[model samples]
Target: MTTTVRWHSIPELVRDAAERFGDAEAVVDGDTRLTFAELADQVRRTAGAFASAGVGPGDRVALWAPNSAEWMVAAFGLLTAGGVLVPVNTRFRDEEAHDIVVRSGAKALLVQNGFLDREFTGPPGVPVIDLKSDGRHGFLGSGDPLERKVGEDDLADIIFTSGTTGRPKGVMTTHGQTLRLYEEWCDLAQLRAGDRYLIVNPFFHIFGYKAGLVASLIRGATVLPLAVFDVDRVLELVEKERVTVLPGPPTLYHSLLEAGGGRDLSSLRVAVTGSADIPVELVRRITTELPFRHLMTGYGLTEAGTVTASRPGDPYEAVATTVGRPCEGFELRVADDGEVLVRGYGVMRGYLDDPAATAAAIDPDGWLHTGDLGELDAEGRLRIVGRKKDMFIVGGFNAYPAEIEGFLMRHPAVAQAAVIGVPDARLGQVGKAFVVPRAEVSEAELIAWAKERMAGFKVPCHVEFRTELPLNATGKVMKDRLS
Candidate 1:
């Protein structure tokens, strides 16, 4: 007898890809290569291991590991075993990781004992699965494979927020909703069968996990997981593997430019970037220097995968300045207060076990109140102004840190910049800038230069330079950490 499966879950999709593209390369990690068929076999074996440990349907399993062949296996294994996957950020400290375990009530933690010179065992009582080693040889595989059915509405994953703002909230996502988003996401990204995708974004992030891996299987693309973001390593992989699709944040592009001298990067064809406004100069450089035939930018939040994406061959300035129009099955609207509201299949089920927070985020009508602020032009292009919380008032005039940061990026020497409001007795609040300079540039010079270009209220009154701005796993500036 067969279990009646209604929706094609992650496992089901992987199995389909294996059947359709059996001999095709599915994953490329270091010296290891896995075809779709082989990848499916490993997933089943890993699922058996989890099943042997009694991790069944609806059970919470925390995954605190980096990107690797084994990370992919464990994720599929847990989901295939009918367990809810909770991805924990590898950067999380012991206490931070412990807090998620307590909140999610994860019964099992699949953690790596050897990463960044740390060992995360978990908070006791919860069983732990250790997946640490150069290869999948150390992963679980001694038990018989388990076959289970996962419905569309079944819980797939619980991803905790980076906690840059207040406490980290767990966002719940389902298999059906996630796959639906990436079906359209794959189209926007122009991901296709046989294409090689280099995923430098951490697996813990929705961008890497769902948008990275899940999208790949949907289109039958080869997955190349980059455990960490190293410029040299990325360039080497791009050249060696002939990666066709490369998507990342603006900083990633900048880093590529820095490391991109005399490299045969002609293999790159489709380049997708977002998470922040990319500088016009940077976009020009990418278009001219890189061999990407289709370059695009998109906008979304943790609640959704990708709502808006620029079409292929969009004007360089347009692609650089604005995130493109909304994808199919999603609606975008700016609230009266300028907050961006998205309603669609991509919206998360809700915050994990946080009804109050979920209610506040997604209203009765289902419009997920994205805390971001944006404007849709007549042409339907979106320009993300800033986050609702990132907007600071100076002498009654509103100042958006993104706008200032965008302008700051124009400076040849500025590598990155973040602006935050500080208490000011006279003006109520003043803009404070945290900058990462590419070269030797003094804070006084930057402030003076900014003062000349921007209005008094918008110009950063305080400037500080650092080797790098505090960033979360997703390359977003941790503004809360700045102060």
Candidate 2:
């Protein structure tokens, strides 16, 4: 699914969207509703503000804020002013956020003041712009849009993903790659014009920033940004605003399923979710019970934009078991060691200012060595087995936590499950399961059930019940925390 390059830069897309979808709702944040033209107008003014603040081409600016209309304007505004966007995780503590700011060499910081009760004033001499208050008063400068020498090949954002070396590495991506990737994502995910998109995923993630906001801009969809993910609040918004598109991890849908029984969610027509192992029964329930006309699961990482995704009319079995075939412009292959490798237009240019690391990640041949383990079927569809680093050896047999977690989810009592290898004197390493159960079930019963259903080595040696598992902003279990 190679796509024709539409508008070259992010600024161009903002202008084009306004021209094409003028007077249409572009964003809905609480009582504030902005039309496409209005949003573009604010973006330009905000860009002018940034320009006045000494930001220029190639300069980096860290945006540490929660999801909101202001966050949207601030991001496009920074890009329009020719500044590289470095979105900091909202969940990060003071030190974490500041580390990215200092490492990215951000010229300025846009902090959501009073958010989470912490003031995010950057290091001395760096200006901090409060996104909420400044947008209305001092930050929204009244001037014509600044003429920035921005191009498709110019760096647009430096998103920091967790690195294997303990420090976060900034993944650099150009405007052209971002636009083209999400354009295909919109096509595969069935995001169309006039759809109201609820962006529950944090804006720091690639899926939230690119797939959520950029895809909406490409398709003229109205964005409804949620800073927080409250199941009841999400349900109310879906019913009240008639939200048509909802994309998140599998856990989001599961929460909705549990809480949205009586709620009117008929407006939700498109859903795309992935990130963790999905229970086949859950997929069946979503398709059968939910009002979504399209439900898809995909596999992607921060290093690559969306790699592969199930289509709208794919069989339930495929949708449940596999993350589907390679998306347009991406080529995928499995290595002999079971690691998934991808080469694509959507691959990041490199880690920021780290040539040695970049060379190691992307070989001379251009294949990005994905640390994930997967098996390609006869039709070239991929079924992700586990992460290469996450695989643990149980005695002599290799045990994948994701594979075991899937089997555990099949149990009727289990709502969520996570498995981590624990050292054992006898087996060398055994599985310890953490379960969030929907029904009362004893640990002995679950262990007994697992022993009958799976190989002895595969069965968990220990089970611990919990009300909820630790989830990151993207809804993936924080397995590191579990360990």
Candidate 3:
């Protein structure tokens, strides 16, 4: 049945879910489990406290925490109270968090005391509320009347992209946009009341915030939240909780496979991996090693939301090859130059207050110019080639590093690979590969493998073997550092 609540407002959905599935398990963390009724009540109380603290509509309330029940409650509370939510990356250093808070103009900040040996400090000048305070849980004991007047156009969140090249810009998403995107995802993934989901992705990320928390709540499903990525812990939770849906990036899945070893994972039914492409060999290993029947992949950006995802029933090749088709209400196109573009309700209003960058990103025709290059097949599936900005010219021919990396990953000995363009006096710029081998593969062997598969220019001119590749918080390889 289709939900009728206004897409822009979240409290309405919370009210409905609580009424419909009050007794169903809503959130689970270790020994902590909160039913829909309990979760909704807590959200109401949290919203009330925030309101009492002078937080109002359009005001930004920053949440700097890991994946936990409190994070979910704070997020919902802020939205229910008509306050904009700004989720800070848990991996952000002190200076980064300070800059984000100042840039977003958040008046209130909710943060965990510490996690994984990292301490989080609230943005200076903003009132800091401790999520772990014993008294913090008591704030949900009483009701505070909510002043819910948020409109479809009202800003709901400001998600900061990892600033690899420069300062991170906050992508402004509206309530209507996020709600609509979740609705589409639920329909596409066939999420229902009985579904049990395992959330390992950080809540600070749009992928986890939208797909894991918001989608589960709206669909009447159960969410199992984890504070950090622990493969063994994840396996235990999946089996114990009977988790039906598993959504994470390729690295998470790879780790899970490694940790599984000989463990039984029969309870897991669908494994959804994305955020970045997965190696074909890894896909094969998951199918052969795990009890999961359906392995899917999804594609999205912080600005456009999750627009493409392979369904559970898709073929193995489709799951490994493409990032599926456009999600409901979203349209995908390949520009003449091969850049991917999307137009949908999920697209952000624009980068917060940065008109020049916004203009460069979203064209006047309403299409969001995804900087990623890709190709659309006859079946409409999108195969991401690489980032547009990451492309480099080699002897007058455009060289996409992701293509080279994808090919290299097929080699049996290559564990991970990243390609970057380095200055060459002869070819203007030649590709250099930084590789991490699984065991002890030599650079000469890998180069021969690439030469056998790719063109001479596409193959690496020089190779460097390292124990590990540098990555950002999101697990994406940092090519800039390699150069």
- For candidate 2, the per-residue lDDT at 381 reads 89
Inter-residue clash pairs, candidate 1: none
Candidate 2 pairs with clashing backbones:
1-328
Stretches of candidate 2 off by over 4 Å are 141-143, 163-165
**TM agreement with the true structure for every prediction:** 0.95, 0.97, 0.94
Q: So what's the TM-score on candidate 1?
A: 0.95
Best by TM-score: 2
Candidate achieving higher TM-score, 2 or 3: 2
Kindly state the number of residue pairs that clash in model 3: 0
* Weakest ten-residue segment in model 2 by summed lDDT: 135-144
Best by lDDT: 2
Clashes of each: 0, 1, 0
Q: For each candidate, what is the lDDT?
A: 0.85, 0.89, 0.81
Alpha-carbon error at 257 in model 1, in Å? Answer: 1.0
Q: For candidate 1, which ten residues in a row score worst on lDDT?
A: 1-10
Which RMSD values do the candidates have, in order? 3.2, 1.4, 2.3
Task: Give the better candidate number (1 or 2) by TM-score.
Answer: 2
